[model samples]
Target: MTDGLYPQLADAFPALASEIAELLRADGEPLAEAVADLPYYGPCTCTATCINLLTAPHGSSGSSMIQLERDGMDVI
Candidate 1:
């Protein structure tokens, strides 16, 4: 869990991080491992549905963004 990829994601939501790795592994173990090694930039600014991983910094424009939800709502 300390390969250093997605450290923030792993530290914040370990389960979600593991699930992402598992999902990626569906394509190939190497692919998953490789992606896991890529840096997790930060959250997205748009309201589009996604895992919330970005590759570059995009400053917010007062738009809503969701991370982990709990009880059907955003929690973190």
Candidate 2:
């Protein structure tokens, strides 16, 4: 993921160790108990807000922009 997409996770926890653990569990990937015991901080304040906007689950203004970016359009 881009740093811009997850600036919080990247800045706080470069590896996203906790989120990776959760995803592993959800995907049924066996992980060491110690791995799950690692501490993780949630998204940074700014990134938390961005995450909220990106994952509203109802409506999103940037969805089109995201799609355009995914389609290789230069938003800049």
Candidate 3:
């Protein structure tokens, strides 16, 4: 429902729509919701590399937990 990909896929691949839905759902949660809180970098439109989150800290553990770990770091 978030985007037309689902319906478009459903139309093209009726038999595999359910499986594709599962992949997009991200373990029962909407894909958008799962990634909404993550940070974003520049689009970098001039080059092949576009916008992307620094995923090193935002894995399954979640952003807040990763922020906590970063906060503990002490630089001299």
Candidate 4:
């Protein structure tokens, strides 16, 4: 549960969805089908190397801060 999902953000930031999809694709992930509708409680409040966005996984995986991984094999 979060304030909202990525779709709402995507609607506001036109290029956001495709950009994320492209990143996921480049990382050997399929066409954004999995995380396309993930909810975000808010941005991370830490100093990690990420966009500072916090996402909650549905089950035991718990929560994590989202990072845009690149080049050296990106994985969620």
Model 4, 8-64: lDDT tens digits are 434444376667777777656664655445555455555566564444532335544
TM-score rank order: 4, 1, 2, 3
In candidate 3, which residue pairs clash?
none
* Candidate 4 TM-score, true structure as reference: 0.45
- Candidate 3 stretches greater than 4 Å from native: 1-7, 23-26, 32-76
Residue-level lDDT for 65 in candidate 3:
28
Q: Clashes in model 4: which pairs?
A: 44-52
lDDT scores of the candidates, listed in order = 0.53, 0.38, 0.35, 0.53
Writing each residue's lDDT as its tens digit, candidate 2 over 1-76 gives: 3334333332455454455555555546565233434333342345434542222223323324211122354321
- List, residue by residue over 1-76, the lDDT tens digit for candidate 3: 2242222333444444444344445335464243432233213344466433232233334434211112345210
Reference-based lDDT, residue 22, model 3: 45
Clashes of each: 0, 0, 0, 1
Location of the lowest summed lDDT over 10 successive residues in candidate 4: 1-10
Tell me the alpha-carbon RMSD of every candidate.
8.9, 14.1, 13.1, 5.6
TM-score for each model:
0.43, 0.25, 0.25, 0.45
**Looking at candidate 2, what is the lDDT of residue 69?**
22
Best by TM-score: 4
Model 1, TM vs. native: 0.43
